[model samples]
Target: MATTKKYTAILLLLVILGCQKQDTVDNFPIMGNLPMGEYQVGFQTLFTYDLTKNAIPYSDWDGNLYQSPTSENGRQYQINIWYPAQPDSGTRLKYADYINLMGRQTNFGESEEQKTFARQTFITQTRNLKNIRDTENKEELNTEQLNQLLDLDIFARLDAQPAEGQYPVVIYPNGSSPAYQSITCEFLASHGYVTVAFAPKGRFSSGMEISTTGLEVAVDDLEFVLGKVSEKSNADMNQVSILANAISSSVGAAAVSRNEKFKAFISLEGGFISAFEQRLLNGSSFYKPENIQTPILFIYSPHPSIDPKYTSHLKYADRYYAHFPKISEFAMLNYGMFDEFIPDIIGAHSGNTKKGFETANELILRFLNQTIKGESGELFDDSFMSSRNQIDTTFVLPSLPKPPNMAVLKDTFWKEGFDAIETIYQQLKSEGNPQPFSMNFYTEYRDWLAWKKDEDYVYRSRLYDLAYDSYPKSARINYYAGYFSMKREMNEKAKRFYRQALSLCESDEDLSASEKSTLRTYASEDLNSLLK
Candidate 1:
């Protein structure tokens, strides 16, 4: 009887220990659903300096002046990359791992005290407890729950071997916070994209400024990061996209407008913020909505006050605006509700929020697959989005009254001839549009007319007339007019144009040495031929 009792007690103890272990595993703090991909995710943090630009003295998150042991010679960047990796290649990273990286920021080799201070500051800011209490779940959680949140598995491994084959690249510019969108970066990596993000500092400080100069700085940093990521063997630079959040969306829009290398743009609860739209997007010359030819996906919270005029500006790109009803902007980028505090620091906890998060991930993946990867998916179809009650998406094709540029004018000329150019120019001028043709456009059109003069003399002469009338100060335009007039056997008119060309070539300081010499020679020859 003693032996039987001893064995039963031992068995009961074993069962209790097993249950405790299981409970610990279950209590690891859920981060919503696991990454739904075949390849494991790999993460890496790279610290490099852009030698072309100078660094500026900046402050930390706690508003303290950042003093590094070594003086920075150039602009510092802390680039975070997450990519598809070989399964089981490296150890999985904890949420704390990312927080630690966030602490390093521009100072990768700081003292222990500084590192700890930065790390704690990052935790405090990322937690955003006040916002959570006010906007999210108000329930006060126990200390254990908050501690468990840091130990959550974030689904990305550190320094894992990259998977075989090239992957599309998605660049996320987080402004000053390198690890702001950690979950989103890892999610894209798991879905077969090499995601890259960097901490973009301001021109005079470490923190990002809200001015136009600040926006330009962000765009420049993005371009530098693009060059660095292109060096990766597994990165398909040809199929790259920009995935931006909040104010960074304006930066992305500006960057996409300048660089044709980007294949698509994804904005997460961004792009239509009133201040950003007016100051960053509309105010900056770099943010040309008409130049954006790639498709755009805008996932935003439904705000009735949002102006539809912003969407109409994107006349050249296919736009899809997805409105998540009753969902906060923070919830779209994060996962799981109240149970997960670290990932959803400022996020709401509700069934609807969870559904919105999942649907957003699906929508993003499908949109990328269709737009960037050239896969024929149902992202644009109504039925595909109809299945999700949490999301209401509307597809807007390129609209009418396309913004006028050199390319538009050229296309109009090609289809309907020079008469269409005159009509459009007059119409645009009558509408109070100043400077119908840019100086570059005038130069390009003049050169184009010169190249195609022999193909159709009648059409060429008409184009030359338009060019000379628009830019009479251009010596090259006058030379071309004289040549075309000579071709039409109008010797007297040709002589008059040639004389004018020679006078401008001699006096026009704007004309280059080579241009003036060529124009003078051609004009003199045409005038002599007219005399003969």
Candidate 2:
């Protein structure tokens, strides 16, 4: 009789399991969804250009610039964006859409074509957090989540007209990961902030390969992204922040240090590496500014590379943490905290982990809200950690007790960067290289200097003249001249330059097709603006 009862109980359990509906093939549980914030999330892709900057030559592990012949000459980046959505707005995006898109990307393991179906299911499972209370769910996602488990449905309907006005945006510039990891972004969009990520140029996506183009190209594209996003009617450019994880953290940190558009930053387990690791491993062209003004929160794990290494010149990662007083917080995850079993396979460095991603998400949400929206100590003042988290720290320069009330990084190293470019031009001139550079940082330096309200334009003016003289027949120079003249209110001079630039655009032999098209369009715009 007892044996009969046991079999009957087993049958009942099996029946209950069989009755549950599975939203995805990977068996992620059904969820109770709520809006990521008071508002639902919306998404759209934005494309913009850096009329002033040109693309650099891209290299691979096998080739250098000229030899490989692959270059990001036109430097077009497509930004995947998520903002607050309307209650009943456009079409909802599926995790499967991103999965299908990113699954075919190159770096997504062996023979992406063979793994597409399984890969899609795996990605979908990572996001179905409501059924599984891991990855740090502050509360259950309500069943009302609509198409998404949360709110960031791709190209989904959002409150295009939000009752609450505009919202802040977080830029996740150039991550090595394909933009398909919508789950990482959905978490942020769920919390009322517009989160943006770029489809990596070279690695995963079959777009313009910018991976070999180096960090400078990655950093410059950020301004163009910022420019286009600000053009959106719904986005609040005034309260923007930048965030990144792992190797891409360096890109975000380096960019935020230079551009004033970012008011806050979040570095998830990446930014700091010792000087030795910087040179030997990561390449040293990151975080050049000795001091950064924007407040940053560094959520990290112990990298065996940087802090505490005798050669890195940093005793602790906190040394790199030393920037603004009371504005920076450093939280350290235990060594190999993310080095667990399955995550190790996906990407140990990826911030999206079932064990810790939710906690990381919570920390980021509170930190962004407090630093960006609040007036006082909203971040770090309160305990913002999970039991798995072990340490929280902060540092400040002894000289600057408070961030100096100055005009957005008074003395940028860009002037020096131009000097280096000048040296390159002379060498290129000797080598008979017709095109010396793809972009000029000289204009930006001048603008940055002016932002400081400086009287000395003489230095950069001479440098610009040198670049023009070297690349005289260059269409890029003509466009630069037109832009420079326009800024100085020399409309007639600008028109002449724009016309010349348009003519030259057709003849720039070294330019890629995309570059030529971009130039023609920009020159026409310059002329049209003058006519208006």
For residues 1-532, write the lDDT of model 2, one tens digit per residue.
9999999999999999899542231332111121245555566654443445443333322333322222343454556777766665555454444434333222223354524543433344333422232445333222343124222333333224442567788887533222333544655765677777774443222233323244445566666677777877667889998876554555665676567677787766654344432442233334434334566665655444545232132111122231111111121121122123222322223342343444555567777777788845534444543243433454332212222222322333344444554565566556654443323244444566566444444444444566567566778777877776776677897898788888888778746689999989988987999999
Q: Write the per-residue lDDT of candidate 1 for residues 1-532, one digit (tens) a residue.
A: 9999999999999999877422122233443553366667888887888887777655654556666543366887888899999876777667767656665666676466654665566556546643653655544434565456556677777899999999999998874344457766777788899999887778766677667877888888888888888889999989999888767787888888888888898888775545446555666756655577778888877554354456665655778777776666556554324324543455444436666776777788888989888898557587776678876556555533333767777788778877887787667656644434544455566667667543646656766776676678878778877887888877787788888889888778657688788888878877987787
By TM-score, who's the top model here? 1
Runs of candidate 1 with Cα error greater than 4 angstroms are 1-31, 58-64, 68-70, 110-115, 127-146, 176-178, 273-276, 303-305, 335-351, 380-383, 399-532
- Top candidate on lDDT is 1
Global local distance difference test of model 1: 0.70
- Model 2 is weakest, by summed lDDT over 10 consecutive residues, at 322-331
What candidate 2 gets wrong by more than 4 Å, as runs, is 1-35, 47-73, 103-164, 174-181, 200-213, 276-288, 308-352, 375-378, 381-383, 386-399, 402-532
